[model samples]
Target: MPRAEFDKPVKVLIVASPYYKDISDNQIAGAVAELDAVGAGHDIVHVPGALEIPTAIGIAERLSNFDGYVALGCVIRGETTHYDTVCNDSSRALQLLGLQGLCIGNGILTVENYAQAAVRADPKDQNKGGGAAAAALHLIALTRKWGNSGQSVGFASDILLAGGKTTA
Candidate 1:
């Protein structure tokens, strides 16, 4: 995978839910390794479950100086529809945050059983946690690229060219 390069120092916040201790640990290890490889600074925070990962990240974005976030957790399917709810809602919340321009990497795993989660969470295997961290870093790099500019871009510039025409 192509890793994002940075000009300035980057800092990331890792929000991990250790509901499944074994899986969560491996995921965190992968995430940390990826961040370290790029010399990105990071801090880790734990939540009780996957559902809370987004909320914790939101809080950090609002109050902390983090450049990005990595969300890590595992949700194994069972007899109840609760698995669907947790997986969908947590993912949706992260997406919403991302839409709002928050640099976030969602590493949450929604799988059929322990075996599936194990494979994906393994640092030496799928390394999805590392993938998620990379996603966040790329977003942070993009943010730095665009946010440093002094002028507006895309549609706004087009509107100005059109003599202040309003889309609405």
Candidate 2:
């Protein structure tokens, strides 16, 4: 994995869903550990479910100064088709936000069962939460690499009149 180096401490916002408290807790632990390893500061916000994670992050992006964002949640299959909707929609929203140039790491787990979710959420196991944090860090590094290069170009016009030269 590529590690991002920072001269100053980076601040990240973690938007998590506690629908499955145990899984969410584990994910948060892993994410926190990873951020601490890289000397980055992080703040966490809890929403009701996976679907709300993106909206919370979007609000933060518009109102706060976080360097990056980590989204953590879990959606296990149920009797109905709600699982698919939650998983797909949440993931899609995060992707769209990323495309808009917000550095975000999606750690939302979509699994067939609780067992599957457990393994992925476990810090001692797959540790996907940590991976998400790393992803955000890498993106932050990339953004910094292209620092301040998003400026819009201005058009300048020079006009020569009969009496004298005029510039607009």
Total clashing pairs in model 1: 0
lDDT (10s digit) by residue, model 1, range 25-136: 9999999999998999999999999999999999998898999999999999999999999999999999999999999999999999999999999999999999999999
Clashing pairs in 1: none
Poorest lDDT segment (10 consecutive residues) of candidate 1: 152-161
- Backbone clashes in each candidate structure, one number apiece? 0, 0
Off by over 4 Å in 1: 150-168
The TM-scores, one per candidate, come to 0.89, 0.88
> Model 2, range 50-114, lDDT digits (tens) per residue?
99999999999999999999999999999999989999999999999999999999999999999
For candidate 1, report its TM-score.
Answer: 0.89
- Best model per TM-score: 1
